[model samples]
Target: MAGKLQVGLLFGGKSVEHEISLRSARNVYQHLDRSYFNPVLIGITKKGNWHLLEDIDQSIDSAPPLNLSLGHSRHTFPTVDQQGGTGLLDVIFPVLHGTDGEDGSIQGMLQSVNIPFAGSGVLGSSVAMDKLISKQLLKDAGIPTSKFIDLTGQDISKVSYEQIENILGLPFMVKPISLGSSVGISKVSSEQEYLKAIEESLQYDQGLLAEQYISGRELECAILGNTVPRASDPGEIIVSSKYEFYTYDAKYKDPHAVEIKVPAVLDHLIVEQIKDLSLRAYKVLRCEDFARVDLFLKDNQTIYINEINTIPGFTNSSMFPSLWAQHGISYSELITKILHLATERFESKKQLTRDYSGN
Candidate 1:
C-alpha cells in the first residue's frame, strides 16, 4: 500500500437507512482500487457508536456490538504505521445515507475536524436533505418540480382533509421531508389514507411534505465533479405493479420488484433535456463530487425535478453507478473518480484564507 491514498469508508449510522448504507459501503469497499487507495472500514452502530472494523469483510449484522460511549474514542481518524506499512486515511468516502449521515451533520463534523470527504458540502447537504428547502430553492431557480405543501406535526391537527384536497387534489404523496430510500413515504388516495400517512410520516420527521402526484415515469440522472459537473445518461426506475410506488421494500427487500433501464428509452432531444436539467439542479444545490438527481417525466414529455440524493446508494445495482456504467465508467472507476474529486476539492479549499488582515 506504499504511496497509496488511504480512504476511510464511513457507513452505517443511526438512520433508518442504516442497512442500506451497509450494503452500499460493502460494494464501495469491494470495488475500491487497492493498489491506488487503501480502504478503511468505519461502522457507526444503530445506537450512534462509531467503531473501526479490523476486518472489512466482516458482516455488519454479525459484528460484535460496540458498547463504547459516543465521542469517547479520539481515533475516529485512523493512523498509519510507517514502520509496519499500514495505511493511514488521507480522505473519507462516506457511504452513509439519510438523516445524520447525508443531512450535513456528518459533513459539518468532518469540516470541524478538517478532513476531506467526498460529496456535497454542509450547505448543499443540509439544503438537499430538507425537501421543503430544496423544492423552494429549485422553484426559485426556475427548475420545474411538483408542487408541495409543507406541514409540521402541529399543523396537521388544524389542517383539514378538504383543505388539502382543494389545494393539492387527490392521489398526492405524503413523505417525511428529510428522509430518503422512500422511508415513511406513502401515496394517499383517500381521506383516511391521507390522515394515516401524515401521522406515520411524522414519526420519522417533524416536517412533512405533501406533493402533487404527477403520474409519470420515475427518471434519474447521475451528476459528477465540482466546478464543471457532468450528467450521466438518464435512467428509469420500473417498479412492479404490485407495489404502489418505489417503496423501501421495493428498493431493497423485494428482489425483482424493480428494473433499472439505463439510457431510458426516449427521444434524443428529451434525453438531452433531462441531462441538462440534471446538471442545472446539481449546480443550483451547490452539490460537489457526485449526486443522483431524480426526476419525473409526464406523458407530454414535461419534466419535473425530483429531490437530489447527495450520497445515492453505491451498490453496483444502484442507479448512480449504473447510469455512469452506461457512460463507460465501471464501478471501480467511479469510486476512484469520486476519491479524486474529493482530493481536488480539498486542495482547492486549502488555498482559501481563514482570516484577513488590513494591509
Candidate 2:
C-alpha cells in the first residue's frame, strides 16, 4: 500500500438508479486490486448529502443514512479521505448511473476540481444521457437507429396516436429521454396504451422518446480505452416470455428474468460488423475510458444502434464486465485497466496548456 494510488469510489445519488449505483460501487470495490488501489468509499444520500464510509462493501440498505448538513455552498466539491484526512484520492472511479450521476452533473463537478474520473466527460456524458441528442448524433454519423420522435415539454400534449401508428406503427416504445435501467419505459400495443405510456414516461422526464419497435435481439458491446477504443465480444439479452422487454424489475430484482449470451451466435461477418459499429458509435459520442453500446440485431441480419451507457453497471449480472470476461479479461483486470485509463487521461490533460498569452 506504500505506492498504491488512492482511488475514491463514489456511489449513490438522488437519481432513481441510486440503489443500482450502490450495487455497482460494491462490485467494483470488491474486485479492485487492493495491491495497486487504496479504495475509499464516498456515499451520496438520496437527499443529496455527502458522507464518507469506513466500509466499502457494506450494504446500502442496512447502513444508516447520512444526514450531514454540508451547508448551501453549491460550488464546493466533496473531499475524499481514507485515513483521517491524512490521504487524498489520486483518481475517482464513479460507479454512479442516471440523472445527477451519469448526466454530466457529477462529471462537471469533478472537472471543475481538476480531478480525473473514469468514463465520458461533461459534454459526452450529457449528450449520451439524453436519448434524443444521442440518437441525433448517431444519425448524423450515419449510424442506423430506429425511427423516433422527441416529445418535449408541452409537445407531449400534441402527440397524435394515429400519426404515431402511421409512422412508427403499433407496439412502439415510449422512453423517458434521459434515464437508464429502463426506469421509465413502456411498450404500447394499442391506442389506449399509447396515451397511458406517454403519461407514465413523462413523469420521469420532460423529454420523451417514442421509438419504432424493433422486434429483434437485444445486443450489447463493451468498449474500453481512451484514444483508440476497442470493443469486446457482443452479448445478447434473451428475455423471458413473461416480459415484453427488459424492464427495471427484470434487470435488477428478478433472478430468472433474462439470460445473457456472450459473443452472441452470429456469422463471422456480422460479428465483425457489430464490433466495428460499436467502436464507431463510441467515438461518435466522444466517450472515454469505458462504455456499453446497446444495439438491436434484426432477424433479417440488419443491425441498429440503440444507445450508449457511459457508466455501465458493474453489478454481478451486469453485461459490460461479462462481455469483456468472455474476451478473456477478468473482472479485477477490467477494473484495474479502467483506473489506469483514468490516470492516463488525467496526465494527458495536465500536459495541455490551459492559459495562453498571444505571442
Candidate 3:
C-alpha cells in the first residue's frame, strides 16, 4: 500500500455513449490489479460534472466532488475516500467513450494540466475522432480507406442525392463526423432514406459524411504500446441479417445482434496483410498507447479502412481485450501494461525541455 500507484478510472461523460462508458468502467474496475494500483472510481454526469464515487456502481448524487490540478489530480478524502486517504492520481485510465471523452476535449484538458493518462494524446484523439478528417488524411497518406464525400454543414445542402449516388454508388453510408458506438449512422439506398439519413445524422453532429458502402466482412485490430506500437490479432464482426449494418442498437441496445470473432479466421498471408494495414493506419492517424482500428475486407481480398476508435470500449467482451486475450494476455495484464505505457510516455515527456532561455 505504501508504494502502490493511485490510478483514477474516469468514466461516464456528457456523451450519448455514457451508458457504454459505465459498463466499461465497471469491467475495468473489476479487472484492475489491486495489489499494485489503488483504483479510484470517478463518474461524470450528463450535465458535465465529476463525482468521486465510493462504490463503482454509484448513481449520480451529491458525492464528494473531484478537482484536477497541475501534474496530479486532487480530491477530498473525508467523503470521497471513506477508507481515509489523501494522495494524487499517479495516472488516469479514462474509461470514457465517444464525444467529450474520446474526441480530444478530455485529452486536451488532461494534457494541459500535465496529467498523465492512458490512450492517445490530444492530436491523435482529435484526428481519429473526426470521420471526414481522418478519411481525408488516410487518402492523403495512401491508406486504403473507403471513398467518402464531405457532407458537413452547407456542403450537405450543396451536394445533391444524384451526385452522392454517382460518387458513392447505390448503397452508401451516412454517418456523423464525430461519434462512435455506431451512433447516428445509416445505410441509404433510396433518395427518401438518404434524405432522412441526413437529418438523423445531423441530430448528433453538425457535420456529416457519405461513404461508399462495400459488401464485405468487417474486421477490427486492437493496438497497444507507445514508442513502437503493436497490433493485436485481427478480429471480425458478423452483423446479423436483422440489421442492415452495425448500428448503435446492434452495438449496445441488443448484444446478440452481432457476433464478434477474435483472431478472425484468415489465411497467414491475409492475417499479415491485415496487421500491416492496421499498423499503417494507426501510425498515420498518430494514435498513441492503445486504439482499435476497424476495416472492411471485400470478397476480392481488398481491405478498406472504416474508422478508428481512439478510446475503444473496454468491457469484458470488448474486441480490444478479447483480441489481446486471444494472444494469451489476460484482461488485468492488459490494463497493467497500458498503465505502464502511460507512465513511460509521461516520464519521457517530462525530460524534454519545455522552456527556452537565451544562452
Candidate 4:
C-alpha cells in the first residue's frame, strides 16, 4: 500500500477487561480500511506482555500468550509486517481499557517512544481514569457532579464506623478511583455493607471514592476533536432488571440485562443541555482526539456529570462510536476522524519550544 498510514493497534493489558479489549481490537482490526491504513496487530497479553502477532487471523485461532513483563521489555516492540525489514509506526491506536492501559501507563510508554497516539495525553488520561479526580475537576469547572469524598485503602480500613457513615452516608457508591468497566465498584444501601464494599474496592485500587448515589438515567456523549471538539448525540443505558446498578456482567456479558438506547429518550432541550455539558467537560479535562462523557440525569432534570473515559470502549456496542453512528458518522468514518485528529494533535504538540534559547 503506497502512502498508507501504518496504525499500530495496541490492546489487552493487565486489567480485568483484558478479554473485552481483545474482542474490541479484533473487531476494529477487521474493519479498518486496508486502502488507507496498514493495520498492525500488536497484542498485549493479560500478564502485561507485548508481542507482534504475525498473522492476526491465525493468532485468533489460538489463545493469546501472556506477557508478564511488558513494561520491563528491553528491545523496542516491533511493528506489524516487520518480518522483512524494520517497520516504523506512524501512529498508535490504543484500544486498551482499564488499569495499565487507560490509567495513563500505556500513554506514557507511547510518549517515551516518541510515537503519536490516539486519545488524551498522560495528564488527561490519568485524571479522567480516576473517578475522584475527574469529579473534582468537573466541580472546579463549575460543572455539577455527584457529591464525593476521596478515601484511601488505609483510611477506609481505619475509619470508625460512625465516621464512615457520617461522611459517606447511606446509599453510596464505593468505587476504585482508577479502574473502569465497573470493576471493584459496589453500591451500598447501608453501613453494614460499607466495610466489605470498601475491602472489595481496595483490591482494585489504592485510592477509593465514596459518592452519593444520584438516581437518574445513565447518559453518555461522544466527543471528537483536535482543537475544537464536537459532541455526539446522547445515548442512554437501560437496565431490564431492578438491580442495584449497571454491573460488570450487565455491561459486557449479559446482553438482556441492559439495553443501550441511542439518542436517549429525552426532551429536545435536555438533549442539547447534555451534549453541551459533555463538550464542556471534555475541554476542562484537556482530553485530546476523543472521549466519552457519561452523566447522570436526575428525575428533577438536574444533570450531574459522571466520569469521562479518555480511551473508552471501541466495540460496536460501545457508546462512543455508537453515539457518533447515530449522528450519521459511520464506524469507519469515526476511525478516520480519530486518526486525523491524532496526527493533528501530534503536529500541534511539535510546535512547542523544547530547547531553551538564551536572550
Candidate 5:
C-alpha cells in the first residue's frame, strides 16, 4: 500500500461487554480494506490499558490508561504508528461496545484532542447509553416508548417489587441504566426475579431502569448519516423458546439461541413507519455517523421505541452491518463510507469556526 491513510482500529474496554468488543473489533479488522487504508490495531485490555499491536492477532495486556499532556499545541504521541517515526492518523474507528467506550468517555477523549473518529459525539453517546434518560427524551419528543421509572438513591431504597408490579405490571424489564449487549438485563415476572434482577443490575450501574414489558415482536433498525440520516430495512430478532428474552447468552454464547432476519418480513407501509420512527429516535438523540435503534412492534400495528446504540456491534453476526448489507453495501464498503463520513464531519466543523477576533 502506498500513501494509504492509517486507521486506528480501537476496541476492548473496562466493561462487562469487553469480550463482545473483541469479537466486533476482530471482524471489523478482517473486513477492513487494506488497499485504501492501513489498519493500526489498538486494543485496550479489560483493565483499560492501551496497546499498539504489531499485527491483527496480537493479544491485549494490562497497564494503566494513557497519561497525555494537554498543552497548547496539538497532542501527538511518539512511535504509536506502524512506522518508526511520527505518522498522522487519518481517523479512528472504534469497535468498543459498552461503558467507557460507548458512554462518551472515549468520544470525549477524541474530541478533546480534535481527532476524527467514527460514530456519535459525547452528548449523543452519553444520552443513548443511559436508558433512563433516553426514555424520557423519547417520550418528550412524542415518540412511543414503554413507560419506565428510574430507581436511584432514595427511589432505589424505597421502591418495592410490588409497587413496580402495580405501576408497570408483571413481566417488566429491569436493566442497568448504562449498559448494552443484554448484560445485567432481566425480564421479571415475579417478586423473586425482580429482587435478583435489581441486585444483578446494581453490580453494573449505580442506577436501574424498570421498564414496562411491551408484548411485541423485537425489531431493530440500523441508521447511518449525520444531517440527513437514513434507516436500513428493519430487522427482527426471534429468540428461541429456550430463553425468556434475548439475553447475553442468546446474543453471544449460544449461536442457536436466536434467529436474526435482516429486512424483516413486513408490509411495505410498516417498513416505512419503522424507518420513520428509527430516524426520529436517531435525530432526537443527536446521533451522528451511525446507530442501531431497537423497537417493539405490538400486534395492533403500533410500535414503541426501545433504545439506541450509538456505537453498535460490528461482529460478523451484528444486525447493524447485516441490515446495511441488504441495501447493497458490503461490510468493507460500509466501514469505508463511515470513515469518509468521519473526515467529512471533522472538516466541516473546522471550517464552521471563524476566528471571532472582532467581536
Candidate 6:
C-alpha cells in the first residue's frame, strides 16, 4: 500500500440519513478501485462518536446504523488523527448526508486539516442543505421555487392556529429548514394535522420551512464535476401509493413504493431544460464534485427547481449512479471519477495563495 492512496470513506453520521449513509458506504467500499486506492472505513455513530473500523461487516449488528465499538476502530471526533496516529489520509469521501456531514460542518473541519474530500465546500454545502436559504438563493438567481416562509424557533412558538392557517395555508409541506431524506417532513391538510406536523418537525431541526405543495411530477438530474459539470439524463420518481408526497418509507422501505423512470418520459427540449437548470443551480451554489438536483414538472411541463443534494446518494440503487449507468458510466468509473475530482479540488486549493502579510 506504499504508492496506493489511502482513501478515507466516512459515513453513518448523526443525521436521519445515517442508515442510508451506511448502506452507501458499504456499496462504495465493496466496489472502489483496489488497484489505485486503499479505502479505509470510518464510521460515525448516532451519538456523534467517530470510530475507525477494522472489519466493516462486523459493525452491521450495531443498532445505530454503523457502530465503531463493534469494529476494531476506536472512537474519536471528526479529525485525521481520530485513528489515534498521524493523520495519514490521502483523501476523504464523506458519504454522510443531511446535517453535520452535508450541511458544511464536516467540510469546514476537513478544510482546517487540509484534507480533500468529495462534494461541495462549506458555502455550497451549507446553502444547498438549507431548503429556505437555497430557495431564496434560487429565486434570486431567477430559478422558480414554491412559495415559502422561514419559521425560526421564536416564530414557530408564537404563531397561532389561525396565523399558521392564513399564512402558510393548508395542504402545505412542512419540513426542517435544512434537512434531507425527508426526515422531519409532513404534509398538513388541516388544522388537526398542523400542530402535530410542527411538533414532529421540531424533533429534527430548529428552523422550519412551510411551503406551498406543488402538484406535479417529481424529476431529478444528476450533476457531476466542477466548473464544466455534466448532467445525466433526467429520472422521474413516481410514488404508486396514495402518500401525500415522497416520504422516507416511500424512498427506501417499500419495494414498489416508487417507480423511477430513467431517461424520464419527456420531450427532448424539456429534458434539455432540466439538465441546464441542474447545471445552473449547481454552479450558482458553487458545488463541486457532484450533486443531485430535484425538480417538479407541472402538467403543462413547466419546471420548478427543487433542492440540490451536493453529495447525492451513490449506492448502486441510487438514482445518481443509475442515471449515469444508463449513459454508459459504470459504478466503478463513477467512484474513480469522484475520487479524481476530489484530488483535483484539493490540488487547486493547494495552489491558492493563502499567505497574507503586510509587504
**Highest lDDT scorer:** 3
Clashes of each: 0, 0, 0, 1, 0, 1
Poorly placed runs, candidate 5 (over 4 Å): 62-87, 354-358
Cα-based lDDT for every prediction:
0.87, 0.86, 0.87, 0.82, 0.86, 0.83
* lDDT over C-alpha atoms for residue 157 of model 1: 72
Cα deviation of 1, candidate 5, in Å = 14
How much is the lDDT of residue 146 in candidate 6? 79
- lDDT string, candidate 1, 1-359, tens digits: 34988788989998999988988999999999988988877788887767667676675545544332223233234433223333345889989999899999999988766778999989999999999999999999999999888877677777777878888888889999899989999999999998799878988998998899989999999999988899988999999999999999999999899998988999999999999999999999888999999999999999999899999999868899999988899999999999999988998898999898879
lDDT against true structure, model 5: 0.86
The residue-by-residue lDDT of candidate 3 on 113-193, one tens digit each, is: 677899999999999999989999999999889899999888977999999999989899999999888888999999999
What TM-score against the true fold does each predicted structure earn?
A: 0.92, 0.93, 0.94, 0.91, 0.94, 0.90
Clash pairs of candidate 6?
A: 52-73
Q: What is the C-alpha RMSD of each candidate to the true structure, in Å?
A: 3.5, 3.4, 2.7, 3.6, 2.5, 4.5
lDDT by residue (tens digit), candidate 6, 41-65: 7888877877667666747324233
Which scores better on TM-score, 1 or 6?
Answer: 1
Model 3, runs deviating above 4 Å: 69-87
lDDT of 6 at 16: 83
lDDT of 4 by residue, 154-270 (tens): 676576656656776777888999888889999987667877888899888889888888888999989999577899879999876666798898888787888899989899999
- Give a tens-digit lDDT track for model 5, residues 1-359: 25777888888888888888888888889998888988877788888878777666667763223333343354332223323334356788878988999999999988877778999999999999989889999999999999897887579778888888889987899998998888889999998888898899988889888999998899999999987888999999999999988888988889899899987999899999999999999999988999999999999989999999998889888999999999999999999989888878988898886667875
Sort order, lDDT high to low:
3, 1, 2, 5, 6, 4
Regarding TM-score, does 1 or 5 come out ahead?
5
Report the error of model 5 at residue 73, Å.
Answer: 4.6
